[model samples]
Target chain A: MKKPDTAKQMTIARLLLQGNEACVKGALAAGCRFYAGYPITPASEIMEAMARDLPRAGGSFIQMEDEIASLGAVLGASLTGAKSMTATSGPGFSLMQEHIGYACMAEIPCVIVDVMRGGPSTGLPTQGAQGDVMQARWGTHGDHPIIVLAPSSVYDFYELTIQAFNLSERYRTPVIMLADEAVAHVRESIVLPEAGKVAIEDRAGPTVPPEWYIPYADPGSGIPPMPRFGDGYRYNVTGLTHDVRGYPTTRKDEVEPLISRLFSKISKDIDRLQWFDSYYTEDALVTVIAYGSVARAGLQAVKEARIKGMKAGLVKLKVLWPFMRQTIDAVMGNSSRILVPEMNMGQLSREVKRVNRGNCEVMTLNKYDGTLITPLEILRKLEEIYPC
Target chain B: MLETAHPIHKYLRSSKKFPHIWCAGCGSGIFMNALIRAIDRSGLAKDDIVLVSGIGCSSRLPIYVDFNTVHTTHGRALTFATGIKLANPALKVITIMGDGDAVSIGGNHFIHAARRNVEIASFIINNQIYGMTGGQCSPTTPHGVKTVSSPYGNAENNFDICALAEAAGASFVGRSTVYHTPLLDRLIDKALDKKGFSMVEVISQCVTHGSRWMGLNSPVDMMKWLKEHSLTVEKAKGLGETERKDKIIIGIMADLDRPTYNEEYDRFTR
Candidate 1:
């Protein structure tokens, strides 16, 4: 196993951990004190791990009636100054859209882990599929800003879960860790990061006194410090368009600014939010762009393509949303063709095609048959894209 | 000036522009008044109280109150309150939901929250009709009542909010009407102090929708109707089933000491 950079100052044990188990460990490491979720396949282990570990780590866990209530509970706990999260599959994630929009509008910091399984509705319970990519972005109504991170491996799941919390806390918005069934259930050897070795971020609290605290005042940062419910700062938080004080409002000026600020706060800091890895992209005619478990296959296919004397590279995305346009543009500028291999009907590939602007031939390799995209399948697609 | 001098005024947010949106003779204001009076009487620190509400005319009560308040989505206030109660366990969490918000769209959360028996005071103001969306028949709209959604003499049966709470395992359940302000205040007080899920179903009048649609012309007419229709739980015990028909039983429906969700969670976790 490769030694992780976060593992330092102590002898770390290389333990075999599943992707869902890694997520629970990462959440605990990041000071997550509250978790509320329902059981859904591929995601049930995440909720189970949280239920077992959260109590031991001085946090709270609740199995809500449904995904809607689960997310609602997480949002409530977040406002009480607790780092909170929930996990679900496709159908449950669909139910959570209502509060996901609420979280975006209210600017409550929380995390949601969508362990993908096949679905329009309960399509494949135990099997894997990546059908919720667009749902994660546009599931919640309105043009709300969201951060979605896609983890490629079990170790990546552990690290990105922590990153998801950091980003959510720093931005005061919801972060989604979109993992497919393959990576979520896969067991792999991963070096555990030492406690306090990895940097953990806590949401900024009101520096001003209770009376002086403006719950939504952004002093130019577009992000404001939040106060807990019992922090003596008696404030109102509503889903409606509101002013700096957090009261419901319909005035054009107040409504316009609140909406604009929510987007600007994250979009402006796109540089910090975007995370990905490019392999052999320095010199390649064809590059494969993918995320989650498919990205792992993409990496292996790229190596096989190189051995076959075909110039194939891979761009594995860690942060999916605010879609790394500049990086994709850079790949487009260099590569003659782009191949996006995913588990859905070209969800991420559609974004790549939009960004491509016909600059390069953007091809897609999609499989939604509740199976992982194999390296051989991607290699075959690469061979078709690049004549070797 | 007189309104500002009122004791409950101190609990109202000075910044929120309010000549509240409730129509003239609306019982929502009456329930809001009783709620604030009860909170004030309890002497819980204002900072230690969190009032959460779902979307409705009744849900707007939290915005006017000077406490840590959250006006959440439709029918999801109890879920949010459950989180807050478990997170702090010290903050007095209260939820105010309308009839439609509580028993219809949010019915699943309502039953589950009660079943979990989280330490939350849920005040469901059953105005019978959806007042905010203009007089649609709610889950609590009486059977055969004519409203916008059920204009041709309704076919659906109404939910008994208190009985539902009792069945769902809420530790404390009570019913009161706007006409019974003292009883409402007392019930609100008991709910706030209860250890587990405490539910108070307030049979309130919505002058604009519920009352006008029901042929009750004014708030006074509705209050008189409530007074005439409701019977104390103690008084109903002596009456036969036929005699109690159409009577809205008011007063404490259930009060049993049970282990709260938070207390039980803390018992093992801590």
Candidate 2:
């Protein structure tokens, strides 16, 4: 049966969709026309939703042989100028690491939604953990820049999916949507954006003639305009470090320019990529840092601490990668102590400590038992940090 | 503009991309020449056709062709080809892979594409060894053949490339060797014309690496050996096991009527 135009059929301006369902809706609204994925826990709902809804929206969905091919297919679709995505967790993410690296190297625009599960290799399939935070950045080999975004609630899940597509298209690289099991499986009410209101972006195609089109050249911006394969540009594409003409080259000097462009394209625009929510950190003595589901608890702890007439606050990152020093500076400006409560044993905490530069006491309250660190635990830690 | 009228020169980017990485006397060059002829013979628009190849000497075919091409990671060409086909069914996609690339590291994607009957032609150049990686023993390396990876002679059984594809439910499966250049081109053109998943296995040679090690050192010796070892399907049929043993049956292994993936998918979506 065909899924009706859900946006038009809605009774209210809101949708009570699960985080995973919201991800699909957001992708649909954001102009994703191709999705290829292999089923994995805490992430399979995306595949299910796409399987049911993508066709109705004139999109394509395929269950690939494995996670590697899932992303390979997604990249393939992206090459044809079709917005593409895939979702996986744990081992599947591990399998996709190399292909993700390929996407970064080739500068193919696509989205990857990774619903975090307890890992290190299938440590816990059904449980939540922000353990993949580091993997999202450095899982793939080599030194390539990446854009990663985390959605804490069902609403952010929907919002971030749209943002993920927009960023991917604009930047001409794969964007990772980082959501833990707590966020992806959570059910919440969200006032969905009006139909045709969500902003969408498309990758620039070659304006030059077929012979003049260089696949990897600087198209004014550091990023090159990528033409769809059948659009007659007929330019060569490779995953190896290449010259602006897109032919493989091993010349050391040429490698410098190719890699530098890959990094500078993202780093130079770090501010635009930087996104986070700052709550009461202006004058607070104690600051909490969290993301994904942990941020939800961190938010509660901030409110509870404020209720007790204490100077406490939080900084939750919506965009994780292209980690900005400005974000850390803003979060730590007035706070004497920084508390990082995470599902993993401190993936983001380590980065926070490094960026904090020993300016203040940065503490990591970590959980690794495939469970969410509750707000009560966060509050208790805060109390211990400052008695009475 | 008149130069582009030549069918072979139209698809083959020999002018700008010459001195290919293939070794002197390597059959991969022959197979690529035949493939271009096949593309020209298929009569598809150049813009609507794409060549995707994984890492290997055989996979380097796309680098020498002017069509929309993708030189992907090793063994991943099939998935990339499938991606291109699925994304735009209006476009025609083809993959160039080596023995190791198509059935070894890329075994899963190969069989699945056949099983799913995805609309794409897979032209596997079975050079019997990892030509680029220095004559290493590959999945298609014949048993008892000595190579770097199989110094004491390989114990692994070789895959019958066409048989495996036919068993996997491919709609079109054909086999020919570099010696049969015209016949090989015809097979590729026929496979490309088929609706669903199709495969054309070209028995290529790695003259630099595999030839000396496998005792076919010279071009003449290799050509002679290829001609002797592989027999026509019609000639080999009904022969005794002793007569047919070690003989590579080269002909149409399978051709069946089947609905393509895009067709089924479009119907379901509608």
Candidate 3:
């Protein structure tokens, strides 16, 4: 394993950068060569940065007509063996769901950055909200598994963008970087790493001859090497369920394993697939579970509660899909009470409750008015539960 | 009878499975033949070309040719083709669509792609009706044309595709018809050689759909109508706007220098 040079160069410093800007830098460092997106607020900076930097790095950047085309272009680029991505917000993300499912069904490796704003439909374009947690998991129709990662800070926006790419390439699936407006617009100091110092993952290419290659046939790693077009590999890939040869298959025998592997590939490899940050859970009777920008408030409230002589801990989820039930259950299992805060009406909280199975009371603090969850409100909830 | 010589025929096999899905005498086959000829003449290897299409009868052109092809969703051929082009700019990307596929459902993508001037050759087979969907009035269906959707007559005015292409900022825009075989062959050849967004709108005959609905029984009759209605751009220039308004203008409408979307995009990254 090549050690990241910057891993040893520890200078705990900061640089002011927007969350979207950080995402662009992280994408650049991760060897992303193509970006196709339409400009939508809170996420427009990502497009601007990519439009400026992609060409300089000998990559491609395009402002497509709409979010559908943006993601469609990214998927098309991914098939040609390019590290491609696109960014959008709520309404745009809604338009991209169909193609997103296509990427999932095709097992194409690409990234979609959703800098979420409040919505059922263009509710709040400038404000932050985590209402898309359920949408990120179930936006696309059908029973397909997805990888969704949420970043809490500007630095994580950069760091997680790289991880999103790596995970997509590793799993051969569309990995979503789900960010809300707060993180997208937030300006913070992020240290730039020297070149050749960040970990990157490249998609696996066919090791066998083109004739011997089955594009969708897994090679023990649960990911089949992709052979690009114009590489003398003639294969058919459809949005329909397909067999190893990439041809659409409807046989009972073929359908079972095809769908089963889609779930198992990510589920069985949960260790490398899941990520979260936990705090102060050693002897706490009360815990808080949150993600994205809301988790920052959750962490602060936990700290405040600890100072007020309340034993409160935090479970900040990074990976939001395949639910990470075991990790979540383990962290919140012994707690007397758990607070699940989000920008929506307890979407993630419902998942927490479903997995908790009555072992601990799962309470929800949801705000859907397109505002970030305030640390004070969370503290007030904590005080009510374990009154000072 | 004049013999049609298309170079792409050399790469094609005349077999049972290869008979093609186009109706017997449909002009789309002629355009497809011309495209294959252009591809063969370009000297680019067959393996290096990627043909993308949206859902429509004309969009089926890619299925007959031996190349990397994607028959994607309706009106999304440009988006998919754009993706393919960006991924491997080395691979020659060509997209084919019909009137509705390119102008109606796919209009947003079409204009934006042209505005960006992505390095792609978009061939819009303008048969004036949605042939695949049973002769519904299309974006290019002429006003007063009777069809399934337009029972009495098509109330909407048609879009002049070449004019639209020129207005949308395509570096190259040309028009031809199945009747103007030699000119179409030359136009397609030139369009392929051009480096930016090249769009060739081929006026075609949907005899089985449009003609049957409009009371024309045979493909020959439809072909005859196309020949009589089509005029060269030079001929149309001499006529008054009202006189030649509805005439199909056949020739290259615009060809100018502009950096392609990929070229401009690459500049930003560097």
TM-score top scorer: 1
- Per-residue CA lDDT of model 1 for B102-216, tens digit only, reads 9899999999999989999999998888898988898887888788888797899889999899999999999999999999989999999999999999998988887756687
Candidate 2 stretches with Cα past 4 Å from truth are: A1-11, B1-6, B14-18
Docking tier of model 2: it is medium
Fill in the DockQ of model 2: 0.73
DockQ of 3: 0.44
- Cα interface RMSD of each candidate: 0.8, 1.2, 2.4
* Candidate No. with top DockQ: 1
Pick the winner on lDDT between candidates 2 and 3. 2
The better candidate by DockQ, 1 or 3, is 1
TM-scores for chain A over all candidates? 0.96, 0.96, 0.95
Count backbone clashes in candidate 1.
0
**Candidate 1 residue-wise lDDT at B177:** 96
> What are the DockQ scores of the candidates, in order?
0.89, 0.73, 0.44
Task: TM-score for candidate 1, please give it.
Answer: 0.97
**Which residue segments of model 3 deviate by more than 4 Å?**
A1-14, A191-198, A218-222, A234-264, A386-388, B1-26, B240-246, B262-270
Candidate 1 lDDT at A37 equals 91
Query: What residue pairs are clashing in model 1?
Result: none
**A137-239, model 1: which lDDT tens digit per residue?**
9999998999999998999999999999999999999999999988998999999877788999999888888878888988789999988889898999999
